[model samples]
Target: MQNGSSLSIAERGCFHTDKFDDDGKIKRTGTWKSATAHIITAVIGSGVLSLSWCFAQLGWIAGTVTLVLFSIITMFNTILLTDCYRSPDPVTGTRNYTYMDAVKSNLGTFQYKLCGIAQYGVLTGITIGYTTTTAISMAAIKKSNCFHKHGHNADCHAHNNSFMLIFAIIQIILSQLPNFHKLSLLSAVAAIMSFTYSFIGIGLSTAKIIGEGIGNTSLTGIPIGKDFTGMEKMWKTFSALGDIAFAYSFCFILIEIQDTLKSSPPENKQMKIATATGIMASTVFYMLCGVLGYAAFGNDAPGNFLTGFGFYDPFWLIDIANICIVVHLLGAYQVLSQPFFGFVETWSKEKWPQNKLVTREFSMWGFDVNMLRFVSRTTYVIVTTIIAMIFPFFNEFVGLLGAGTFWPLSVYFPIEMYISQAKIRKYSFTWIWMQILSVACLMVSLVAAVGSTHGLITSLQKFKPFQSVS
Candidate 1:
């Protein structure tokens, strides 16, 4: 068997591949480039916006160090799981089509169900968070326009529910698209939008510093001053760790992304390369945005550089950046949600093999339409949109999700699976070292979880649900 070759004995043919691919599915046309686009679309999201504030809390040394450290950790674990894309053989064995499939193959059937719960839970939260973030970005544009037209001091509060509805309607239509194989163009466009807005943020930050000399900053971070107490500083530093963790949270869908790639060149190898490239590209942007923003505002940096009135003079540029955020999130929502969609549909089909509504696809106009997919997906979008309209708190919850799942999904499970898949001897130096790394990461996750919890609590204390703030 060579590249793109699928060979199985008569007994295993039905399970391995119908003819070309495992499970006789459609052709996997994803390339490393498209995979990179998907990764970028998922990783470089609204989380990047708060990096400057994280920098402000952790300062030049720890801030930059944390960003790079997370990138390395993320890349390492991603490569570990990427190698598990196929079972019995790293490259040519039966495909583990989903994260749960990989878990079941390497770990066990019981762990497979837990992996589904964790992975799908995180992804569901992400799609809901994206809906809120996109709506907020849209509202920010309206707020910016309103503030510019009216005086800044005047009351300008843009309603968010209507904007959320606009997003939901657009998503309902886009959701009709079958799967990730058809989403390469959208992912590429979203990747471009992410880059555009990120560059705009960097440029704005650089311009501000050039216009006005650097603000007061310390190597360690904001020093204890009258306005900022020592206790608050400690909490902010821990919370900043959570923020940085949230910035690199694409591990939730790494396997599914790999499943989309072609068999040639080995999907594991291609995914490893894409993981490195995507993490490096995103890290560079994160450094620039965080460092430049901190240089501009220093201790007084806003949580979101674009939406927090950092540069009100260049109104049009701000509008464009916000619009880019909206566009990027539109694609990100799908990139993050499609795996969850695939999981549910796959389960339903297994349960109801005889139900046409559950498994049948009919050609409509120019597209293939599955009645179950249409109803379920549309209902999902509407439900998430309604939740966004009600609660609408995005960052803290996403940060919490990142912190809570980072150890299990990004570090622990991957390392454990790698050890089992590779059959590393017990108590060997390699196994012990990997275990040590997992424990260390678990401790770090706990710290981040505490920080995220505190932040979410503080935010809720000022609680007014469904209220839009400028």
Candidate 2:
């Protein structure tokens, strides 16, 4: 038998590796550089495109502080979790355990199941949000007057918008093809695209800052919007932006960490280094994007944040931004699909067999539901499609959903995993600190989701206007 091919779980619940090759000799080593790249790609996603909107909501100083704090907390929890995951069980000795497994081994099965469901929900939510973001950006680009359409040619833009949606779906399907190695490659490509946008944004922002100069003197003569008058109003705006920052940082860091760290060789340091670098790099990009965006667009930047720079042509900027977003979503789709595919693989192997005969025989009324053997695949397609369709109707609500669900995965879950696995195991000051920080992160997400959702609903109610830009 080929080496490692016969490796399996043993009677002791330990995993045994087949050491001998066909000639009874050990195989050589594999390089982990590509594996490191995967970690970085998984962390940076579509959320980066929305950082300026989040900054606008929170304002410059407050948003910066919140982002910094989130990063520090994330770093601490990740290091701790990576260290604590040194359990002696050989079955768990591999580096690439799922977040659900980490939860199970450290926090108990109940919490594991709960985290599993949440993670699934969050993954689906993210996919939907990306779809909506794509659709909205497409619509904006089409509606812009620069795309001159004499007479009924205007309807051509609408057709093109729908085509973009179909294009996005196709991209997703292509990414889901059988080549697993492609994910890491796609991730590296995404990093390149993201840096392109970040640098462009920084250059534009620096130009704006130099033109404006420092102090309230430059601020005074400018004609500000009537609604943006008071210091109280500004504070409220800043606070809302802070919530957005909380959501962005939370989601980006969490999904990246869980995917990369869990997939890394359990005792290896290389993957951890790669994962850390990815998250930190993303954080730096975010800060640069925020500063640059605010400089060019000011506070009243439009809904599709990155494309809303007043200094540039909205149409061109949006098209470029939309392209970057599509690439980023590709990475997100891969990482999210990893845990999801793993879940299906595990469940089908362990649970599907026992239920197969029963499920086939038990008809729903007179209808034979064995047709539902396709349930898992059908569920994924339908749920993803429906959520993607409905979410665009309330963009802000979906944004918050992305934030709230992602925060737990990012800020709270890793720390909890660490605390649960600490050799001391029993309660201690460090555990207490972790819990406090975890709850705080959770609360911030809760507030962001609730606030954004409320804002969305109220806006939807006041006007049902289509053809008007939000």
Candidate 3:
């Protein structure tokens, strides 16, 4: 197969030519509103639920700073990526559709492969995280109701893996949807779910604080200069940074989301606007959830805010939030997994161009089905589900993947691509600043990755296979 660099200028010119309609305009399907919805859906996932614990680790001051900085950096990276999306080649009117395509066009074949590895790895990790989170949410609901009725009997523990499997089975059915653009409505629903749960969480936290004074709460983390070593504080701070960064790390799908937007003159500009609006809205929700949750629980905040609440008095509302989470993750799994499905399908097509493998059709209950998509997407969901069932450390695993890949995919690649596309000179102000940003993020990511991985490994050694996470 011809790699990006191996493709001659003539071959490059033909790229994405078919995307245009007869009028020579790119075929547009989604609006800026839908694009914003997709961005919000992609950005706010299980990560938001963990922000209170993150703030506990970092303290209010450090946590707020980290969240704001990461938000800004993420927005900058998104803008840089969208700029690369439709910047036409001098000869070819071809536009890049995927993250890997953009990397290939600007960087080369080798960098493209590297980016692909990181991109898919991150995407797969996210799918697993969602699966694990869905199961956890379901289990939380089951256990909370069980405890409320049975008064903490160990026998009442619902089989957590069973819930994971159930959700995984549900995802198998949902994954059959044909393409990402077709998921626009689901994305909008996911966005609404995100907002709904976040509002509920914030409200509950506020109610808790009002019912029981803040002074009565036991909070975690050391205030600056309060009986803690600098290294200990640094470790906690960086770990929290990883969680916040993970919350904002949605760069992988930026191009795909942008491609769904209606093609217009201010194309890149529109995307930036949508992106900014989404990020800002998400940031507000995050701050409210994190700050209020921490204030309510103090040092006792659980990694998952909902789980921490247990079966409180207003149990019905908690159940509603948990249900929303499960529903949202059902869609979230597809949002992340669709790209992986596309990757495999694209690979299959290239490897066997004339074999009619992916295109092979069959009848199932009078519905036409593509066997290749059915098998590939089903296998992907199953694998992730199995992994989630095995490990089941939702927050820890999220931090691990976020810390490991955030720098390379979210920070380094965008900066590197921007520099290459703009031909910024070495040591130039723009180049140096971008490099510094990448390096700084890389350093933090590495620290958080190592810490989270070590913590996970230790947990695994003590963890029994298929054990319930609660």
Candidate 4:
């Protein structure tokens, strides 16, 4: 008999309960709930850490409105992109496995190549950011403990590169999971961790407000003063654009997540439901965490909800929250970075379909190992770790990458694909409106990129390469 993968669908139906999909791949078991789990794992990331700061920069009015507006746009764009999962026929046509595949299927080779560069460039930035943040979280845990042991004013300095190395080693192990289909449990756990830390942050913020009273707040945000010069305020407001965008910019992996779903109930329909549900859940949490943190600290809100501000009471809880961040990022790093994984592995497999070194799987500790997967994943983790060690700025990278890729992958491509697939008349009301929306989003991304870049530059002056960041 042929190997399991080569078995005919009818044979597998008789031998196993799992049903193969149209692509003749292994049976998929992803439900809307699991897809939601994946979405949460990807969406609630380091960006969430910076929300309170973004809220502070934009203040009450713009902060609240911007969060809602981004959630709306993300939901709308993802809904459209969801329908583009399957080719000519979204529900029944041949499957497009990755974002690049979807682009090639809908748009053309020219666009596909361009999309790859933008997609992977932002993806690399994101992975590096995650590595840095994970180190910070780990370092915070140690520092929290040290402070508790020797009073709040004790020298609790901790280096982050060692923590970064430890995190990278963990990722190298978890990265062996093979694919998104195998990551359900990890994603679910990560989602729980995300909520755990988020709730803790909210609780701390609430406690501070109750015990200390409300902080200074305004409709227009922080007034120009010793805290922020006029130019600083403008740039910060612009950078906040990226922070908010980063919080909602998970559309790049929407197709990959949707691909994991069972074909029945239609992948598009289920993904749409999952996207809407996940976005709503995250939005509610973001609104609470951001708004409350802002209300508690107002103009002086910390850059990170958990560690940016002064040490919160019940120091143990603060340690737990930071620990949760580390755990959550362990899963999130894989989830967000899977798109690049799929792109590279898929291309390698197709390029050398029969090369045993690249394609052959060997059983080890009940897990399959292949050279392509091993080399590619290990290399990625190592490279990101080195970069994270060199320039460990979380907010700067998140903002810059988020703003850089916001318009193209999340907004522009989806709109362009919708127009192409629907055969809409040129310059019709719908087409004109879509074009206008894309242009508006593009302008927003440009300004955010500038602000984030400025912040990065400013940060660089104080940082030396390979210096241990605390």
Candidate 5:
């Protein structure tokens, strides 16, 4: 039970070694540093881009409250899932097994499949969502003449559309390549870039707020009857809380969590610490941006707005935000695609010359493994791109996707997993509280998801209902 202790229980005689691979492979044990990095990568992503939008909706006060509440709920679930791995299996060991296995062991096949569907669906949705976001960012940053409607205002639509197409193509081709290790450095870069942009955005927003008070010139004449100035301002501040809740619901990031928690030196404590820090950093960033953006734009802020405050030309900030977001999305896709592709490859027993997991590594058996990867990668690219293009028309459709897909997966599933396992049953009071709190958070998240989806639908009706923007 001690650090790196070697013990063989009769139930788990197959996994009595201290040395291990991160994914529970029977190799070298992973160190704490890898676990920390993985955690950071797992939590940081395009979620930041949407934070401002959420803040605009819910107001800064409610937005802050939502962030805090969701962070606590999410961390609670993370700790619970990590604890589930305490009783390591002999065959798969502790470092490499997944939640699927854990759920299967506790629940029946039907429930397990249901849980898998939730997990897989959320992961796929987020992957596609981020992919689309990435394409949009790249396109925005690399504005082309074809789409540039104005001489001074470069139109990024055409270029972004083209880049998205090519990016999808490249992802499909590279997916056929089996070197997942290459993504490690990319993931780290993505984490840093995302964090930097979010942090910088926050800093800028904070400075603007402190320099120029929260009162808006646009609202100077608007009468707030019977309400004192302070009360009216407080109400205005709290208006964006729902948006914050909606944003937090989408934090059901799956791939990075799996990678971090499953790496060669799986240190659960280190991962928890890193994730906690990331969430805290993100909350502060969101609050700062929300407060400043609201002050600067006064209710006219863009839905996906990040840095648009106190700048002579706000376009540069948008461009920077776009670049950082695209990188973040790539990292997100890289992480999400791995387990999905890996699962498919393992299921098909794929083996290839270039990609052993997917090609015909051994022709003696006349089995071609790589065929599945080629097909899957191509299909995913084509299908996801089409879906992405179609869905972007719906105002905040991607944000809603995050809420619908991830809220349940990130918040509900973990609670369900823990309850099913019953490891904490001995602590009756704690167990009851867990159930109450889990259900409460789940209900709030569920409402936030549904309401946000409805809001998107209403907004779309006012925009270009069922039609592409182009």
Candidate 6:
């Protein structure tokens, strides 16, 4: 396999040479541990919080099945992506540092641009989801505290938009963290937060089931045809699949995360192990949270487990969970947004090579700051914050993003790239099975996208901007 030596002196100079060690390998600032932490952080976002509600739509059996299938599919796709990262270049060996780079190399320039669009779009939507979730959790905490201190007549309503704006302002600082490697510590914290909330949610659900009895639980283990028409039920099942797909939709950045690992052949092996560990850990967490939340609330489960149960009992615990969620999202918003920032910066540099606006730095309080980074990232955060405020329905928006982008990026693109790189024959067993899986995923995601889009539009019809929405 080709290494960095494949690059021309000029091209190598353009690269971050400092990142390479004396041994000529890219310095591995991240380890399997950090990679695992980052993957968990990336995979178990606010989407996991909605799995119980997802199960409510698909029932326990289907939801569990979908989650497991997605876990397996995601692991396979991630491995394919890691393989694509080091394709043998005829001239320079092979090296791909980003998803777009891999796409361009394996697919084509046009496909690369298309992938860029989907990648950034899904990432922006994820940032929006994070912001929206932060606001909702904050609002819930505020209301709970107010109701506890004041009577039922207390005006406990807090505008979610206000909290979103505040969170966006906070991101203005967090977004300045520079790069993925720099964000690893934050990612570790975010991973812990994910575990924290998952355990708490599971604990609460278990307690509820124990205290309240199974009779009070929404214990429909399987789907009932009589509850809805076949079509409606199918639509809901597909929608739930989209949610599961989205919950596992971190493949777009897998290469980027892998790039942060120590540069060596073992890096690929390390990534495989990390991917397996992260996916398994997250899948178990999702199952526990989803199953327990469903058993506790049954058909009445809210889209977000944290907000589904009223914030009355164990108010302090709920408060801690919400705080963790808000903080975790603060890190998550950055994890997803950094790629978008890099894309814009790279485009700017290429489009106007001599334009100082793209790289100009100024001093602020004795610290140098990039004007472009501040403006672009802050603007992106503000735009997403506004969208979050407009449509505060977390699950629906998350489902919409998952359905709209997961198929293309997570399933179709990776599998196609794999087949292209591997030269898999059209009728080969592996090729046929993967193609079938891709098509099935695509069809299900399309149905989910349409359903979620309709749901969002219906929500918009009733939306009142800046108003407190339950």
TM-score-wise, the better of 2 and 5 is 5
Give model 4's clash tally. 0
What's the TM-score of every candidate structure? 0.94, 0.74, 0.90, 0.96, 0.75, 0.91
TM-score, model 1 to reference: 0.94
lDDT string for model 1 (148-260, tens) is: 88867867777888888999999998998877888899999999999999999999888889999787777998898899899888777777787788789888788889989
Clashing pairs in 1: none
lDDT of 3 by residue, 313-416 (tens): 46678888999898888777788777778888878877876665565666789766777888898988889888887788866787887797679888888888
Q: Tens digit of lDDT per residue, candidate 5, span 254-345?
A: 32344334343344554556556666665665566655666655445555555223232345665676677766666657666665666666
TM-score of 3: 0.90
Error of 6 at 371 (Å): 1.4
C-alpha positional error of residue 246 in candidate 5 after TM-score superposition, expressed in Å: 6.4
Can you write out model 2's per-residue Cα lDDT over 1-470, one digit (the tens) per residue? 11222342232334323532222223212224554455445545555555665566566666677777766766666665555344433224433246676667777888878887878776666666655555555554555433433432344334233533564556545433322333656667766766765675676567667877422222222234675656534433433543444334333223224333323244335445654776688788877776566555666544445544443333466456556666655565565555665467456545655555323434565643433233454456456655555434434644565556645667666676665555445557766776777777767666666666666665567643322232
| Shift in Å, residue 37, candidate 3 | 1.0
**Model 4, residue 125: displacement in angstroms?**
1.0
Candidate RMSDs in Å, in order, are 3.4, 7.2, 4.3, 2.2, 7.1, 3.7
Give the per-residue lDDT digits (tens) of candidate 6, residues 1-470: 01325344335555465566423555667888898988888999888888987888877667778888888888888887777766653113466778888889889999999998899889988888888888888888887787788965788777787788889889999888767878888999999998998888999999988988642233343345586666665555656666777788898888788878775545677788899999999999999998888888877777788976774567788888888888888887888888888878767766766666666667888766777778888898888888877667777788888897778998888898888888889899999999999998888888888777766776789878767465
Which residue segments of model 1 deviate by more than 4 Å?
A: 1-19
Runs in model 5 deviating more than 4 A are: 1-32, 86-96, 142-160, 177-182, 203-266, 307-318, 350-359, 362-369, 393-395, 420-422, 459-470
Q: Write the per-residue lDDT of candidate 4 for residues 6-87, one digit (tens) a residue.
A: 4575445544445555555777899999999999988898888899889889988999998998899889999999989988
